[model samples]
Target chain A: MGQYKITLSGEAQTAIVRHGEQAFPFECCGFLYGHENDGRFVTEAMPVANNKKGDRRKQFEISPPDYMKAEKYALGNGLQLLGAYHSHPNHPAIASAHDLALAMPYFSYVIVSVKNGKAADIKSWRLKETIEKKFAEEKVAVKHMAMFSD
Target chain B: MAKIIIPTPLRKFTANTATFETSGSNIKEAIQELTGAYNGLTRHLLDNDFNIRSFIKIYLGEDDINSLQKEDTTIANDSVISIVPIIAGGC
Candidate 1:
């Protein structure tokens, strides 16, 4: 229902591919590392296991160690947290009900859905609020970003 | 032939495929067959006792597997079984 021009740099593409591979059958959650000045964002896949104690609903928790490392990497590169990424397993690359509820105000959400072992599809979304405001202000523009496979 | 829907995380264990035609006559047999095929997926779906882990839920044709027959639930040839991992996220 929301529209925006989402660009993915080569690095972001690879990061997604790697994350897709690592979190097979479950959701892979990680952060997008980028800075305003860099003109390009690089995705670093952080390994986070699902913390669903007893429920089979899709859940994700960035491991503390991985989180710290991502934070460190972002800080060292003067990049900001560009967005978050996760996988959809067999479902389509659409945001689930849980996804919309957990989304913050201004961040990109990348969903990678795998069908039959292959990365079937990928898509991006800005929070609804951001999408609405972009439409209102006519600034529906987003910078390019890439994912690293490693 | 039961339609087994694979979750995204477990795809790696399932040869990176999503849904597959499983040849198990029932739900338990089907899952067992799948686990037998993908050694790494057994741990994520079943615990040490080989029981369905509390963290995973199975749905058989829109019905919750727990209320029906749990893992022993039978699978119709046309049934669609989904294994979706309940995901909990931290800010």
Candidate 2:
């Protein structure tokens, strides 16, 4: 865990895991919207279509329009587009080289490992601002909220 | 002047400025003015051929520039330009 951390709301976490399981064997990607105070506070996890052209099994792509829509949604909701989350089917929740290449600075990348259609370890990483870009592990904090009956 | 909304990731190059106002009339000229103001943003937003990078998507309002005239798309004084980077990755 590094100094960078992301706190995901309970609903956000559940959405991410459920998405990973639903998209089993293939990659699922989405946007994370929240505020950046001290650290990232993820309040929502909005799933978007995986627009990758070929070999959807090991790869995922989010179209520009979808990205714009997500950003607009965040703005409309009084939040910022903090980062993104994706699932790695049958793989570890680690940032890959391909991830490093596509990653941009100042955004958190959350990776979920789905093993056999079940969501397993979940981790987050941030791209280091250096000539040789690399991912630094980020501490994930899941905020659990108690449910109340009306 | 067109308003260019710089994404969070690229804000560092602009001295942490979130939005920039440029007097350029078209998308290309607006970007040129932006880069001229912040020299560090040149490589990140444009390629060697001075074209917008494939991974970077520039939008004139809600429409993607690719769907329009691309960099040559004329921008209104009140037009909003957004720079969105493609988010993709694999295992």
Candidate 3:
């Protein structure tokens, strides 16, 4: 129903893929930051620890405080909270029903598919607020700019 | 019918099902139907007053109930309601 395009630095892309590979069996989750107004153009990927007590391989959870901290940090700097990122271990990079259930409308959810402890496919999705609830894929525009902020 | 989603942590109480179908008109009614239909959910979802606990956050579609009317947020038919618990504390 609707679509979003995000610009991530090459360094930011490497951070999330590396985070996914290093976590391997466990899932890694993080938030993306960038300036906003026209569209979300993520320039940074900040990986945080997955604190979910559930199966890490299947589920990744971010505490509310972590969100607050990320928001504070992003605002303190000169950026906005663009979206979130997570790795799906041994699963395809597709938005699950669970992801859709928890997705916020304006945020890009980047899901990296890790198979056999290696990053395979990467995809971004957003929950579209159309007449019908739809999970739509977003185009990720990787920029070659120098890293904005680690 | 609106869809009420249960997070993974609470799935053990919902027979391992992640989603349930309900015909609740509002968020409060939907959650009430959820806890009432499922066993072991009443305590986790509500307090002794049967009010939704603070830690549990409900989202109607993409809007959080807190930004809406809390428990009184309206739910449309075929809406996806996510009952996400606010995971906080601990390292």
lDDT for each residue of candidate 3 in A1-150, tens digit (9 for 90 to 100): 246777788878888888988998888999888876686677889999898897787888887557656756775888766678999888888888777655654567888888898888778887665635577888877788442233
For model 1, the stretches where C-alpha displacement exceeds 4 angstroms are A1-3, A37-40, A43-47, A51-57, A63-69, A130-150, B1-91
Cα lDDT tens digits, model 2, A30-143, are: 999999877789999999999999988899999988987886787688998888999999999999999988898888899999999988788999977776778899998889
TM-score, prediction 1: 0.48
Q: Which candidate is the best by DockQ?
A: 2
lDDT of 3 at A63: 72
Q: Report the TM-score of chain B alone for all candidates.
A: 0.90, 0.98, 0.92
For model 3, state the Cα shift of residue B19 in Å: 33
Order the candidate numbers by lDDT, best to worst: 2, 3, 1
Which is better, 1 or 3, measured by DockQ?
3
* DockQ values per model: 0.05, 0.70, 0.07
Model 1 lDDT tens row, A4-38: 34455566666776777566766677777654443
1 versus 2: better lDDT goes to: 2
Top TM-score prediction, candidate number: 2
Model 1: per-residue lDDT, tens digit, B1-91? 7888775445657786768788787788988988888887886688789987765667786677888977778888888887755433321
